[model samples]
Target: MGRAPNTPYAASRYSAGGDGPVQQTAFIGQAATRRRLLGGALMAGGALAVPGLVRGQVLGTPSLVPMRLSPDQLVDMKCCLRPLRAAGPNLGTESVGGKLVVHNYGHGGSGWSLSWGSAEVAVGKALASLPRSVAVVGCGIIGLTSAVVAQRYGLDVTIYARDQIARTRSFRASGSYTPGSRIALVEPAGPQFPDLWEQMARHSWRMFRTMLGLPGEPVRFGDSYAVSDAPIERRTWPADPAITESFATAGLPRQNSEFAHLDSRIADIVPQAVPLPPGENPFGMPYATRSSQMHFNFPAYAAILLDEFFGRGGKFVNRVFHRPGELADLPEDVVIHATGYAARDFWGDRTVIPVRGQTGWLVPQPGVNYSLRYRNVSALSKGDGIVIMNNNPDLGDMLGVGDSMELPNRAPIEEAMATLAAIFARSAGAAA
Candidate 1:
């Protein structure tokens, strides 16, 4: 992976040798050397440090909650392929055998995060046809949201998909608001994409904010911490042309630099991460940052969305389309093509790249409400379950890019659990 370009809040700004305050604890004897050795060992092993050795508890700082991260606690695992396109998502209108088809798929990992806003775009195009009814080809988040938005426009809508929302790839998402995650490659997407992306992201953010306090807590905000033994590096966009050009032959998805970091365009609307001083850092890692993250509890959120759709007279047809010609058979003249990764085959779109992602779920904990990222492992405690994912930056954006295997692998999940176990074990040692 290439070196990431720095930003204002990059590691240099908050590192120990940077502008941040330095630790002033006195080291008077050999005991201090032993403590340093122990800290080095824990850091090398990807473990947290003892609280007493770091600093006394900081006021208002919450203690880290332990999670049952063993393989035995794993209830289920799911894998899905994110539809990635080098030029970003296909959000244009086209004529399909005399039928007006609006494209709304290929958002990559940002499907869930950008659904509402993208739906607004696709539905607006569909409305221009002045059709009495419309059909959505898939029941994933994108398709479902498009149907709901169409219903809001007083257009009779029906979804035609082989499976419902629960079985679709969107259900396996990490559920965080990550609008810029694997969205598009920098050179291919061109200059105009950032402004269009900002429009979608800001609209989606506002729509999500409307669901914050709804019944069943479909959407809510929680603190998420990114902790590390070394300074945290934040990647910026407009990577080197040589590096961006290598992505085509590398046979892997574009790395962080190659992807457009459109989230920064809406930075003012989104919560900014703040560096955690030693006292406020609960993970005991040498460096850490915290930011408010919005999460979607899919199980509850899906139910609310489906109920609202059904109540508004929206219908669903359990059908599969083998090719674009099959879409012409539908009763509606206007169709929102939201088949997601299936578009790679059905629509003969070779640009739809498959980026595989998997998540392991553990039974929900009672009071574990926050999220954490240590090393390459991430744990999110949502209302449905605890989502454990391997987001290794060492692999860059190519972590699971170009892979289409949907089978769940336990080895990765078990390895991630071991990492979490080590962190919690050291946390317990500190509490003792």
Candidate 2:
């Protein structure tokens, strides 16, 4: 076969040099030399240091993670969140007020982190009751993930959704590694929920780690989330026992974010986090902080995972249920509720607000590896791709610290041009 069309994604010649003339290719006159030192960008399994790059590649495999590796799996997307279209008429089996109800919804962001842990808790109730048939509502990240977990527990799960699995908010998301406001104190809190939140975070983080071991999918790289000024205190908790116990083991300091604007329940988990020196910050926000994160390509990862679920004896039903009575017809004993933003209407959960985020990605700028986000708006370069992280809107959230609901009408090409132009303008301005 002739070589495939390069399209516009062909690597830019100027990406290698800071602000130099463009070369005809990704490699340069000195590229042969640099190639020996910097062959590629970093992935989960293999990595090497080319002296200048901290998280990029080296000449050979340096202590590979012993898992399959495929850098080609990385794919850039240009899409928008197809928000739920309608007033869902409660196709719930259990009662909201009193009908064997177990409601798990309203994860504005951080749905991935809270997915497995939340499903674990939701399924625990159904398992205790010994239901033979279970019904799962919504096929967003929460629903699909919950169904997978329920199936793992040997429950026959029927996933019901109005839209196709890959067309929801889950797909539209620029899946960053940070956990946005999935859990909060909007509900009256006791010590109980705080413990559960901590437990859920740990479990979700571990699940993500396991996923990183897989090959040819979106899950890799250590990121440093630069959080600016924000309030980290005054959140409520839940009422769960096992969750509480597992949380105490976290060894996190209480009043940690209280005395300061920073908290550290996960500082021990991520290996790379330290205060940046005065000149280390990229955008120069008021305060610069760094915490390792995982920027993801949601479509690739979800496609692989969903295929695995369906292939492994899992069942999914595509129907937009209007009443809770419709769920009773499924062939299972236990049910898990994993609907995310859809819960806004399905369960009358108004908390599932849609916070829109706009990101501009140019053709791969491989050398800019470090993810730099001080506000919700950020600029970072992937090996051969790029994305701007989104946020779940909340009070006290810093500038560019929250995703918008503006529909992200910007196209990738437009975004890429704008970003590159901005960089070019800044450089030109500095020279003058």
Best-matching candidate per lDDT: 1
In order of appearance, the predictions have TM-scores of: 0.84, 0.62
Clashes, model 1 = 0
Give one digit per residue, the lDDT tens place, for model 1 in 161-224. 9999999999988798999988988777899988888889999999999999887788988889
What TM-score, to 2 decimals, does candidate 2 have?
Answer: 0.62
Across residues 17-78, which tens digit of lDDT does each residue of candidate 2 receive? 32322333342344344445444533322123211112211111111010111223224444
What TM-score number comes out for model 1? 0.84
Clash pairs for candidate 1: none
Q: Give, for candidate 1, the lowest lDDT window spanning 10 residues.
A: 7-16
